[model samples]
Target: MTISSRVRLICLTGALALSVTSLPLSWPNPALALSDIKDITPAPPEQDPPATPAPAPAPGDDEDLSDEAFPVIPDPDPLIKPSNTDESDATTPQEPAPEVIYDLEKAPEPVRRMRQLIMDAAASGDIQALKPLLDVGANQTQVPLQTSDQDPIAALKGLSGDDEGQEILAILLDILSTGFVQLDKGTPDEAYVWPYFAGKSLALLSPRERVELLRIVTAGDVAEMQEQGNYNFFRVGISPDGRWKFFAVGD
Candidate 1:
């Protein structure tokens, strides 16, 4: 009689209708009255599906992901090593300094002297002698006795008179010919009289004969002769026969 009782009654009626609708035609054999169940047959069972192949494993799957995956390799000891790279030898190897060889036969007088001076300086440990000779090829302005229009080498040819003088002359010849002036000029304090001449007379000598003539003059002892006239500051004299002959000192 109330709203709750009415709702319950409607639900009961809907359930009864659904049950009746879903009922089979017969109680036990629903298709018993059908002509043939075989004629209305079900489809045959599907053959078992072909087996699918498993996918191949990715590379390095067996490798460990842990910190210990790859072993650390220590560097090989240098002492015991042979290498895939270039292996350096342990022996102390030396490279020789460049050497200059002199040909005594073909050597010009100047070259011979240059060699001799180098040898003598090296022997006596008087290396200062080497400087002047080395300067033999430089300009004449450096020579103390340099004259206007006079060739430096020729001037040296005119001066060298002894063993020391010859050495100086040789240096002069070498420098004049080679024009290679890469060394120092020795000081007068070193008593570099001959070597100094060689250094000073570089680039002045023009001929082999001039060198020979200079060698003769340089072989003498040099001294100031005299002040001949107003313009004549006399040094060592040249004779009419082209010899280096000292004259009166002050007359």
Candidate 2:
């Protein structure tokens, strides 16, 4: 409460304020200050590097891959696999092949002699020469004519382009020159037909047989006959008993 005591207290307070003001103001070191702060933010999530894309394939690579995945199959052999054409159908009925005989000695004596006589008459180039062989009877030689009652010799003349009937003679010679076939053996219908094609199927001919057919007819003619399924040309037939059965044209 005395003046002197109060003055001393004031002086002591002033000295304390001056000491606080005179002291240097220093900031904390920057690196040490940041380290002092609490790390509240969550650490960034761990991340993987971006993946690289695969390279693209070159041209034709897809085809090469496909070939490796599925191999190609080859076609079957033709000999092993038959075609399904109608001509080769197994269900179709085939004609029985006739026995073609080329050697004249195989024929009976009567048949051989009669054939030779006919050949001689045909080679003579005279239609009338055939009249004697064609007698009027039940066993008489049969010929293609308009009427059954017509005279065989006269009918032949009418058929020929020339009056001498040389064309008919040539046709007879051509028909008898080839091979012959025996049909319906030991039966009343049995006969030896000239130009074996008369009793054989044109479709079933061998290469050599086809050549024989070509000798008597043209390729176009043979093709047409094949379509018709038989030989259609001049033919001569003789019975086993040596009788000249027929000289005709047609199936």
Candidate 3:
């Protein structure tokens, strides 16, 4: 035979031997036979396109990534409103400027004249200007409080005759300037307080004991003023005719 025919004959013999070797030699369980077993790894199912992430750019393609390939940032949400987080900021409602029930221009003639006298006496420490107002027509009896060393609330004029009388005058002026808020007569607090120094209106009281509050507050006004550093508000007590009974620093 020729070389080509000999080569083909040898290949055919090898394939027949391999096929015979692969065949089962003995009988086995029919349920566990090779034909009965299914493949554990089925041909890989086709992958879905949506599950894949977008490919990142190559290093050479990263030209000034900050400016060109800018990171996507979410914009502010439209549903929610921005809030003012600062506690000290002025955006919060400021205390409504205290309503001035009495100002220099709006005050009655008697009150205006009295204020002028007090101002002059306080400025010059001269009781002479205060003498006319201190007289009985004014219903002001210039009685000495005889309580404190300064006796600020002692009399209408305080100690205007003395050098430090300016202090007392200022206190009285602050009291007069305080706004008036009418007290409810039906209230039990107002009823119990009616017997003392008869006044129709209430002056905000900072003291605990309302019994001698009238006298104590008069003396305490000076201390309270010194402590506060400013006369922003005053608890004012006035009679039906508008005569001030006693005034003290209050809300």
Candidate 4:
């Protein structure tokens, strides 16, 4: 073979190989790929679904806050109130008292008997009879040195400063004028004479006068013994309990 012919045949073969290799690597137009994307499956929706949104609450609804939700509370001290009430109930008001009245007519029996004995002695001056009577039972009542009209006890009260002896003398005179007298004895069945005098000559005298009169009576002095007999029927008065003795001499 000739050189020129063989060179042309080899060049032709090389050119064919070059063209084949470059053709598959060339870029296509974007407009031409739109149809191809439409045909594709969209990649199966990205595998995970979207998260669900939370629901909204209703407006204006009120909440229940009742006692069943809590509990009852009690007082720590209960007795204090009742104790105060009891103290008030226990208090009570007191009543006032009444006035008293005295009745002398209702004087005790013992005091009456004592007064009677004194009256008898002053009236009779009967020494013998009084001795036997006093032996049985008698009581001499003490005579105060003030008049009943003068409030006896109050008049003789120490505040008055009156001599007790002088007041006592006045009392003896008053008693003699009004208090007692001895009756005169007479014939059988004769009515009694109201002499208003038995033997009162020695009745109203001081202690010294009484002693002198007693001596005169004992000696049978006619002037002193004329009014009453010398039998000396004077009182030997004693207390009801026999606690004392008294002698009244007769003229």
Candidate 5:
């Protein structure tokens, strides 16, 4: 039934009850009236306890009270981003190309002597002596053509600055003394080695590059400590089979 009808029925019931209670015992059907009662609605759920107001403050008290008890917490400072500019600039470096490992103690007399010659040339600013030594482990085809002078040392010496010449020779000596090289990107039988820095190609070498050449050889080095022969920028190439190809130093 509609809610209004139900409410009316309830009102009528209440009225009849009141009237019956006031009626005298002359009524013939009082029991029948109650027996016919129908469709009584359930009692409304108990109402929540009335919210109590906060106790009034004393007349002399300094602090005033509130009806609500929820603490008024202050908002936190705006979230801040940490300054990580230096950390961000500290990017993870690329893994180094494998080096040529050399053992001077066990090296053959000729090899040791060759290493010494290159070192001496570099120390004395004489590229002439280091010229032939450069080709020891290198392929002939990779050598640059000299139109006027076939003497590799003289040609190299004539071409380089004093300081750069030494640096170039030092790098070559390091390569010549290398024991083995690793080509992470190449297979066991075949790997490409950039004797010069990949950043500096043969066609584009500066006068400072001296007689150094480009991709042609591979040879890894031997060091008792990690930082002994480490370089941030250099070119040391070798064949996958452990042959020296080209070697150069970078700025």
Candidate 6:
């Protein structure tokens, strides 16, 4: 080739080398450019900051009420209309007063005679004196003794602490002295029972009635009878016809 053409070709080659050397070593990648674009884009409008959870309720909140917590309501008083013009006038039901008799003169002739006879026998202080009066079979005086014993005198002795039965006689006198009540009036069972307390309720006893009872027995005895709801002491029962119905203890 000619020298001029060779020199021109050499200058062209050196220019191209200098231009390439002046450029940056790292080349811009297409994938890196796309990643940078994604990073810069605004995040989808921040979706209303994920709803915050509601605060918990305080203690005893939203609980059911118990039956015990409610106040008790009492039943209303019964309706009572006033009998008189006065609104405060109220009448309450009361129990009937018991019929009590202290005098023996009010009794029939036969009863009085029989009572006198028994009193005389008891005053004698001899247990045998009562045997004649109690001799009638099936109609004998009903003494507090076992059914196996048929003899009234022996039964009296058994009841007495001593062999002569003076204690039983004393008890008989004490029983006959107390107030009496005539039960089953006009009926076949009509009889005068000594010590009216036997058939009467201890709870309903008046102050005077209690005094009469204390005459024959102690306060402790009345208290015990009150607890038991009945009298449990010796008593005598005589029919209107003067027949001795019973001479026994217990209700």
lDDT of each: 0.38, 0.85, 0.45, 0.38, 0.48, 0.83
Model 6, 1-251: lDDT tens per residue? 89999999999998999999999989886566654665666667656778889777779697555669976688887698456656456566665655888888898989888888888999999978887777366776788677655577888788887888999898888888888889878898788988788778888888988998887779999999999998898888899988988888887
Clashing pairs for predicted structure model 6, backbone only: none
Which segments of model 4 are wrong by more than 4 Å? 24-37, 41-251
Tell me the TM-score of each prediction against the true structure.
0.19, 0.60, 0.27, 0.17, 0.28, 0.59
Q: How accurate is candidate 3 locally (lDDT)?
A: 0.45
RMSD of model 3, in Å?
A: 19.8
Quote the positional error of residue 64 for candidate 6 in Å.
23
**How many collisions per candidate?**
19, 0, 0, 5, 25, 0
- lDDT of model 1 at position 97: 21
Worst 10 residues of 3 by lDDT: 189-198
Q: 73-145 in candidate 3: lDDT tens per residue?
A: 8797888665665743546664432332434454445444554555565566544444444434344332444
For model 1, residues 76-149, the per-residue Cα lDDT tens digits are 77886565454454555654322212234333454345445544653553334435443333321233345665
In model 3, the runs with Cα more than 4 Å from the true position are 1-100, 104-106, 142-144, 147-164, 173-251
Over 4 Å off, model 1: 1-44, 52-113, 125-128, 136-251
lDDT value, candidate 2, whole model = 0.85
Model 5 superposed RMSD (Cα): 22.9
Reference-based lDDT, residue 88, model 2: 73
Which of the two, 3 or 6, has more TM-score? 6
**Candidate 4 CA-lDDT value:** 0.38
**For residues 1-251, could you state the per-residue lDDT of candidate 5 as single tens digits?**
99999999999999999998988977585465756888589989999999999888889886754647656677887789666899967889977544433345543355345445545766775655555556542253133335634654544443445634664565555544334333445454343333323422233435443223222222232111113433323444444433434443432
lDDT at 234, model 6? 87
lDDT of 4 by residue, 113-215 (tens): 5444544643553322223333222333222334534433343232222543233223223333322221222322221111112224334445654453443
